[model samples]
Target chain A: DVKVTQSSRYLVKRTGEKVFLECVQDMDHENMFWYRQDPGLGLRLIYFSYDVKMKEKGDIPEGYSVSREKKERFSLILESASTNQTSMYLCASTLETGDNQPQHFGDGTRLSIL
Target chain B: SQKIEQNSEALNIQEGKTATLTCNYTNYSPAYLQWYRQDPGRGPVFLLLIRENEKEKRKERLKVTFDTTLKQSLFHITASQPADSATYLCALAPADAGNMLTFGGGTRLMVKP
Candidate 1:
């Protein structure tokens, strides 16, 4: 079984503070993604890393960035947290295409910005 | 712009019945479509995947159908139990190398026993 783990299951931060969400996968998948899920809006991709040190912006990337310094770890960074940024964040990983791989997700982190 | 839409209304059904969920997309042709199950407070778990050329795919109690011409996919859970209740999301992968997905707002399923 594949295991994707997020650093925090719950987090609270004040407005203007910088926040970090960490994710690690044991499967050594080449592709990792960060997504924020909001009520009614659904899951929107924030950023994704196809390989170490390579990142791409997804649909909703404003005010957020990502880091992939190693193959097993991916991190999501919020430059300045705001109340609107409060939502559940999910991390997922999958092998590159041509392998017919499906993404494995972490439990998710519920973030609260006050 | 490519977009995926799933019925946002919760689907309520009696136990031992089959529950069907719908997903529709527009603008882009996907190489494959995927269905996922998400329980409250947990990330989604992959359930099934149907390729464009394939008409349908099945895994135990779960079945998925893809209609490329209609730009729609249907997910079916047969003999559903209360444990089958969850939000079911449909995702699509573009026909390119990256395989980035576009997801729809999920439909919540409630199985009454």
Candidate 2:
């Protein structure tokens, strides 16, 4: 079974603090994604990486950045955390070459900015 | 803008009954659609995927149907148990998304014993 592991399951940070959320996939998937899930807004994509060293901004990329230093690891960085940044963050990965392949998701990180 | 809409209200069903969920999309033509199950405080797990050419797909006790003309997908769980209670999300892979999926708000299913 493919597993996607997230660094933290729960985190609390103060406002103006820097926050880092890490995701690693054991499936060697080339495509990785970060999303923030909220009550009514659903899961909004924050960023995605097609491969190592490549990143793309999603719809809600403001105040968020991503780093994919290696193929299996993708990290989401919040340069400065704010109260509104509190959300359930999810990391997902999918194989690069496939026909309608589904994404595998990590357990998620529930980050609360106080 | 691409949009996917799942039932915002929670669906309450008795055990041993089939639960059906709906997903509708607008302003986007997706190459395929997917369904996922998520428990509270957890990320969603991929359940099933249906392509544009396929009308219906099934696995175990779960079935998914996609209609391109209406831009809708339906997910059904047969003989649902208490363990099946959770939030079900529908996602779409837009042609321009580069393998990334856009998800819906999700419908929460509560199976009562």
Please report the candidate that would top lDDT against the real structure.
Answer: 2
| CAPRI-style docking class of model 2 based on DockQ | medium
Instruction: Identify the runs in model 2 with alpha carbons over 4 angstroms from their true place.
Output: none
Expressed as tens digits, the lDDT of each residue in A1-114 for candidate 2 is 889999999999999998999999998898999999999889999999998999999989999999999999999999999999999999999998756678899999999999
Candidate 1: C-alpha RMSD after superposition: 1.0
Error of 2 at A37 (Å): 0.4
Model 1 C-alpha lDDT per residue in residues B1-108, reported as the tens digit of each score: 878899989999999999999999999799978888999999999988888999999999999999999999999999999999999999998667465777899999
Candidate 2 lDDT tens digits, B13-37: 9999999999999998998898999
Q: What is residue B75's positional error in candidate 2, in angstroms?
A: 0.7
Please provide, for model 1 over A12-106, each residue's C-alpha lDDT reduced to its tens digit, 9 standing for 90 to 100. Answer: 99999999999999987999999999988888999999999999999899999899999999999999999999999999999886744578999
Q: Give all candidates' CA lDDT scores.
A: 0.92, 0.93
Interface RMSD values for all candidates: 1.5, 1.2
Q: What TM-scores do the predictions have?
A: 0.97, 0.97
Question: Model 1: runs farther than 4 Å from truth?
Answer: none
Of the candidates shown, which would achieve the greatest DockQ relative to the real structure? 2
